[model samples]
Target: MSRIPTRHLGRYLLQGQLPRKGCLASSNYTPRGSCRVAASCSCSRCLQPFSPQATRAVHVSTSSAASPADTPIIPLRKKLKDEAKQLKKESRKNKAQKGSAQTVDGWELTVGIEIHAQLNTSRKLFSPAATSFNDEPNSHVALFDLSIPGSQPLFQPQTLIPALRAALALNCDIQPVSRFDRKHYFWWDQPSGYQITQYYEPLARNGSITLLARDGIAPEDGDSVTVGIQQIQLEQDTAKTLAQPGDARWLDFNRVGVPLIEIITRPEIHHPRTAAVLVRKIQLLLNAVDACVSGMETGGLRADVNVSVRRTGDTATGRLGTRTEVKNLSTIKAVEDAIIAERDRQIAQIEAGGSVVGETRGWTLGSKQTRRLRGKEGEVDYRYMPDPDLGPLLISEDLVRHIKESVAHLPDRELDELVDRYGVSAKDAVSLMALDNGARIEYFYNVVGGLGKRLREAEGRTPQQPLDLELDPDLKKYAPLAANWILHEFGRLVTDRSSPQDDETAFEITPEGQCARVPVASLSELLFHLHQKKITGKVAKELLLALYHGNVGEAGGVTAAIDAHDLWFHELSEEEYGALVESALEGEDRVLKEFGGNKKTYPQGKLMYLVGKMLRLGPTERIDPVNAEKAMRSRIEELCGTSA
Candidate 1:
């Protein structure tokens, strides 16, 4: 073997080509187009051993007939003329371990995301396979999903509505004419070997999502980052593949042909924290619009993250470092973790006189480094073409207008209403809409509406006004109060851990004894009683929990439920109050030692607390604490010369 001469390694990356060994001054350098792809390594074409030499690859010829400048594929080093700069990055992470922190100028971090949202449609995109989870494996597969000889996929017009709804909510420019293409790939999950997707012309494009700065992001630096949405396309879900005992592979086609909307974001996210926030915001929006359930635990929603780093101060401009594509991040937390880990890996590689290789990587939940799945060269070999089975989708004008009317309340809009219209505190508003459970939020409105009606009825006025209107003065007092109880106390009542009385696996239930949920109307009525002083706050909280759990038995209605459970506040009878006052003033002469038979030395406030405590042990009674104090003071004065 000839010893290789040392040289600056910039010529290997050009025209979408990676030099297998040439980029890193490898001892084994084969000229381009020399060999077949490696059997085990999974490189697209290069047979050389997988190395850590990272750089962008665009292969060009030095032939006299072809001009390198004509291709617009000029290597990045040519523009900057900095071989020394490429050799070493700022190494700020290492420096920060010492005392001083130095800001690394000229390096920019860029991130893009591809989100897969399972469409909440009745049937699959192409086949009539029932779109349900946990069904028998392969039970839901249709002939079209398996690509039978004559079976063809038929488009469901109803499924198009949901895809359009998400696109419109994202502020995307919906393309009236979009066509589907076939993405060819070989995997155990995809029996059809090609995925039907809108790629050549996607469903929507050129939209943006705005995320508020969070996780201690300083306002002076930037209060928010608006990442760009590149496109939103409708696609078909593939089957799930499971690795079994003895390294065996199992295929479950139950999820095949399920509809999905793929939202691709631009390389706008700079920080890992920002990427997490952006994905969370999009997930909430998808939930709000009913486009996806956004349940990472259930595999209903997932994201593919594209993270790249550059050497520029502003994230807006720079020649990017090689990026690693972290695939199939099921959780938002995992996305953030993977990005940070990949970034650190790239920075370390560059610092250690190696380049960051662009490749497909996987993340184990607790691990910090990404595991390589495949190289960038192999991953990009998915040859795409127009599908002969499908035609261009023609979205009518009426359809767009109708879909727009359907999605009236989105996450941002609801947050605004909670603060501006309902007078909910801004901080409280965010927590309310953060998850974007439309049903839960809608129930909140229903409960508020019920409160308004009940208050108006009490005032002997018609309860016909719109609940959206500023409620009657009587009900207005409970707006913030009710929100506090619902968001905090009542929320805890339903979602918290099981009590001693509850079963280990607690699920939603109702007081009716049927497999039903407690009605929002009933909860509102309970709150109404609390607001009107018919029940104490403590009674109200217990009452809500009682109804939520099975503690309360079956009843006729909301009022009946409260009465049946005896959750109403009880006022102390005059006899009980007098007896308590007498006991405190005259103590037990035989059993009580401290302050026994010493009425003149007893504090009036202590006597009142004793009286209240005795009452609390029995019932939460309304006692005019102030008047009780006054009466106690008078009684003490009458009994003793020194008590006053």
Candidate 2:
């Protein structure tokens, strides 16, 4: 390279396609060396990269979007957020360590529920004696139930039907090969030393029931949640244990060997309200099917709820936090309190960076928090085995189908049908379905159906297609009216007047069971008289009350009460009643005199109202408003001056 100018040194000059020396930017640099410039190169005054006496072209470098310094040791700001959160948590812990407490979300509660219902039976499961609640101790206990030496169980086919119905009602798949097992759990009341249950083979499996927090919700509404049924099995109930605190626990064996159907739900409930609602649903179902005399306030039917909780996103696919069991929660309020306490406790542990222990805890009514009882154990640890003494229950296919057919009506389905067919609102239908008397549903159908048929015959026409009560000429007007009376007025009579238990003991017949106890012929006779307007609604209420109070015998029944108590029977044929109705028609002079003196503008409604008022008066000093109004209307319409 020619030393073009003394000023050009240590700088590359662009030549055709070869490297050429450029003007010298650094006075102390040489050209033949590698492209390394002086590390300390700078403009003399500015102290930046420059050389004296050299006009060098510079390519300004742009900064990158990121840098190694800017990037975290890992990458992204999520890590920073997480670290900050962790640091805050640690600070809280340190504060707690410094004698100041900090609260946070910690342990999660998990819950599983086991619901037991007494099966409807004619005789005790393993006994010849009767199966009755509230009976004297040992009264209903057979030798087998008492677990006397060498005694054995005798299967009852009738007892199994209710259990099967329950399983099907829950949408469970009935297992063809379910077997019974002996579950060992010691209690003072367990005469047999073991509970006969089904662990390996359950009667039902893989089922779910929809639960609505409040009533009247549609099944498809997301507000309704599904609760999974782990299994439903038939078992024998233990005897009642009456405890005396410091004294010995007295065993009352009357309930021993009574058939029980146990329903175990999977751990799906997350909140307290959901738990309460689930319990109510199960109880209602049992009541609806007449399977159990469930008294939530009492222990006739009991619920065991297990609860637990865990950190959110603790798992890759998050499940609920680990839970603890809240066992034997009899009251809905108690269940609510237990869930709240457990949830708070779990969240606190997790937030404190401490692990929560899963265990069975009993809820204290006064303290409102659960105390640990025993460590959580899995099902296999229960050591369930087949009962060696009892052979496998072989229910024939015919038997299963026949049992299914026997229960022609399912409450849930009937409830829906009532809503759709009768044109009844959902809420009204729910109330009808909630009636403790299962027969009321049938009674309602018969009342409406029979009345509609009579009306159709009077009109000389067949009932309309699809038989909509609202549209049918005979029934459209009265179906809802009848439903209201049956659901409300009649229901009140049944509830307020009926004794809860029989006279011999405190055990009363179940409302649904009571319906079965009533002779069908007697009920039909009562309804027929009422439909003929032979009795007023007031008398009907008294009659029903008398019937509910156990007054029986053809002459001594409700009809007698109606006779003795009715104040309006004397008004049935008052001479003044007819005069009042006729006066009401004549007083409408405007109608008869105005319509070319035609009766087209007749005050028919006012006349009927007056008639009804008179009919309501007591017979002794009363007038028959109904008969008066009817006579007046008939006479007015027959007048030649009136429109035909």
**Predicted model with the maximum lDDT:** 1
**C-alpha lDDT of all candidate models, in order:** 0.70, 0.63
Clashes of each: 12, 43
Over the stretch 1-644, how does candidate 1's per-residue lDDT look in tens digits? 96543332334443533334544223344445544223233344443444457343322222322444465676666746665555445455554532221112345566789999899888999987788787788888889988889999899877887799899889898898999998889887788898999888999999997876432222322877677899999999998888899989888888888999999998867777678777777777887787876467678888889877655653355466677899999987898778877876776677688887889889989897988999874424778889998888998888888888888777877777676668777666665555334444555566777777787777777646544445444444666666776578756765675766545534443222122445666777887887777777777777777767655555555568667767566666666666556655554333223233546556545656655644454333556454445555555556543344
Candidate 2 global CA lDDT score = 0.63
- Model 1 ranges with Cα > 4 A deviation: 1-107, 213-221, 312-317, 377-380, 434-436, 465-476, 494-496, 499-505, 509-517, 554-644
TM-score of each: 0.67, 0.56
In the range 1-644, model 2's lDDT, one tens digit per residue, is: 55455334312232112222342443435445224344443434323354566454432222312443464354335667889999999999976643311112333345678888777776877667788777677777788887789888887777878888788777787888778898876667887778888888888898898875245332223467788998999898888878888887888888888888889999876566667667766776776666775456657677777766665455355666566776767765676667767767777676789877768878777565778888876766567889887777766677667766755566556666666667666666666655443445556666666566655655567555426644664353556655776677655654554355543332223443334334434454455445556665566555655555556556655456555656334444445655555555545565444434434455556546545644444342344344565665555556534533
Candidate 2 matches the true fold with a TM-score of 0.56
Candidate with maximal TM-score: 1
